[model samples]
Target: MYQQILAPLFGSLGWSAVAAALPLLVLFALLGLVRMTAWKASLIALAVALAIAMFVYPMPVDQALLSATLGAAFGFFPILWIVINAIWIYQMTVTTGHFDVLQRSFSRISGDRRIQAMIIAFCFGALLEALAGFGTPVAITTVMLLALGISPMTSAVVALVANTAPVAYGALASPLVTLASVTELPLADLGAMTGRQTPLLALFVPMVLVGIIDGVRGVRETLPATLTCGITFAVAQFAASNYVSVPLTDIIAALLAAGATVLLMRVWTPRGAEPPTSEPAGSRAEVLRAYAPYLIIIAVFVVAQLGPIADLLDAVTLKFNWPGLDIRDAGGEALSLTEFKFNWLSGAGSLLLIAGLLTIPVIGISARAALGRYAATYRQLAWAIVTVMTVLAIAYVMNTSGQTATLGTWMAATGGLFAFLSPILGWLGVAVTGSDTSSNSLFGALQVTAAEQAGIDPMLAAAANGSGGVLGKMISPQNLAIAAGAVGMAGREGDLFRRVLPFSLGFLLLMCALIALQATPVLSWMTVM
Candidate 1:
């Protein structure tokens, strides 16, 4: 068994941390500055990480390869699985001409681009994030915004930005659940703390989304609606996560915000409303058909996640150690991450496939046509598949080789300053892995350990990890690939990366400050017990 050494570079944690960071620095520099294609950048970064694992961290070469292979397998099965099926379901809607009807229905709500953005990109996008995390919200919403005649870049940015607030509670609070398991903390406490933190993020996202769609003018004209949507979402999110169910937090907030936006649109319309972007509205029956797929998705997920059903679905999942791989950390404890859980039947992607099949009858599409669309989605997402798999491989190499641990350990060595840097760990994790669940898995225990070392509240730091992770979702290479693919702008991921990078950093800074203050008397009351 190969053992990890945290400080493998001349026995210095600081120098080791810098070495550990080279892969990430190379990735962002290539994607954001050099404008290299995503797949190329990912492959190069993967090479860099593997090299570091073998030479710098002095990991066994075979072990690093196995780790990468495991990650690539995971990336394809679950991560790419979700994206492929979601886009296929969408393509089916387009095939049956329901997508146009859906567009008309939104325009009928209010033709103003800003209002449409608030409703579609922020509110509905949150709903998508609630039920289906990962790249689903960004992929689905970017296309919907494109249908609304929004520019490709703006639609991608809005989808990515709006994806933030609901994320920590996303997929029925999966990220927090993971965090709880890793940190050995109470799930409810982590959920409540995250609820408190992200609602503040929820409060301003609609305004940010509107501004992205139409600049200051959009924010000025749609202040009433954005405020209504944002405030309702923030309040409901706070209540549901704190008092209500954590799993249902995003769902509750998203529905309430959507209802509020719809109610406001009935009485108040934004200034400078444009003409309807689609053909005349379809009959009520057609409208219902247009919406049936998404409804079906929610229903399927809810049923699948129920106690008995969820257990049964999970019963079929396969869990086993990766072949020919065994490694312990510096503490001589085996890394449980080396074991893989193949939740094939119960995975979100499988449920989405079920939802798609159920949708075929409701939307009146033939099974054959649906299959054709599925194959087409595969063809469309080919590069996205490569980019995602390679990126996840990079994540795995970094994780298993102790490259990520070195970085975290080095940062934790900062003592009291670690509170301010806590959220950045999560941000960096998610930026690399593209999932808050994965980020928390990577950094949750690290955060708790560091917080205890620094005399900070472990719960606050743990929650901050997830809260900061949401912002990085916007700039993740996998999400960028998904957004670009959805808007038919594939290979322009570099452009999308450049567009969302500033927003990611800006929000991360704010989250850093919030977490830092929460560790002190200033905002300590805002934290949960």
Candidate 2:
């Protein structure tokens, strides 16, 4: 078996870290500075990563190529699987003329665009995030905001920013579960620690969303409603994750936050509220028809994920060693990632596909028409498919070739100062992988190992990895492609990237400060320990 090495460049951790970072630097420069289209930039970056894997890290050429193919397969099966079906459901609603009816129904709740954004993008988006993480929330919510007359770019930005708070508990706390498994830490402690941290971010996310939608004036005008939603969400998230259940945290927080906002709107109205001009709101029956698809999705997921059903699904899941590629760590242990788990029937994409089929009759569409829409959806997402697959390929090549470990190892050399940089490592992970779950998997054990060496709390460090990774979601190439595609701004991903990058960095800094403070006696009590 080929073995991984931490410092392949002159046995110097510092130089190896810089060499390992070139692929990512090339990626960001192309996307951010050069403003290149996402697919082209990703392809270029993938080439750079392959070069580094073969020459810099000196990995076998065949193994490096095989790793990329595996990642590409994964990116399609699970990641793109969710996005394509979710968007197809939205397309079905549009085809049935129910989407416009849904828009009018939302306006019937409140005329203020800002309040509607608070409800749809922030509150409702969290519900989607909880149910189906990955790019599902971003793709679905951006289109929803656009339906309500928000500009495409603004809708995408709002959706991306709003997706953050619920992510630690997203897909029923998958990220926390992954972190727990990787670090061998208590799942409850990881959940509890993350619950404490991300809820603080939750407290301010609505306001940030308002500011994005309507500038500082939006925050000022809707202060009461924003405060109400943020407070309720933060408190409920903290309570559910710590006291009740980890997986239920986002569901509890989202429903309460939405309910609280609806209640606030009853007693208070914001200035400059303009009702959306559309056809009259649909009848109760039509409104129910309009909402049936999303309700069906939630039902399908809840049923599939519960007790015996979830167990049966897992039993059918095929886990096998990846073909023709085997590499061990520096310690000579086989890599777990070398094995691929194919959850064909139980994957969220398959569930979404099932939901799409169920939605056919509910929305008065036939199988023939639905199949046509499905084909069209595939054509619509063609480039997004390429962008996502290539980005995941780049991630796998770097990971399998030990570029990621080298960087993490170099960063961990900072001793006690590693606590402050812990979140940055997590941020970088998600920025590359476009997944908090994947990020925690990549860096969770590294964070805990570094924390132990530095005499800091491992739980705090691991939780920080997940918390900071959430912010990086806004900048991930896969997310940018999804958001851009959702709002019909495909080639303008760079614009969306530029719009959201500042907030991503600013929020990451806040998370870093919070994590650092928690490592000290000042805020050490906040950790679950």
Best candidate per lDDT, number? Answer: 2
Prediction RMSDs, each to the true structure: 1.4, 1.4
Output the lDDT of residue 320, model 2.
Answer: 91
Q: Which pairs of residues clash in candidate 1, taking residues 3 or more apart in a chain or in different chains?
A: none
Q: How close is candidate 2 to the true structure, as a TM-score?
A: 0.98
The RMSD (Cα, Å) of candidate 2 is: 1.4
Tell me each candidate's TM-score.
0.98, 0.98
For candidate 1, the lDDT comes to: 0.90
Off by over 4 Å in 2: 275-280
Deviation from native of the Cα of residue 164 in model 2, angstroms: 0.5
* Residue lDDT tens for model 2, 375-420: 8888888888999999999999988999999998889889989889
Q: For candidate 1, lDDT tens digit of each residue in 208-252? A: 998887789879988998999999999999999989999899999
- In candidate 2, the residue pairs with backbone N, CA or C atoms under 3 Å apart (3 or more residues apart, or in different chains) clash, namely none
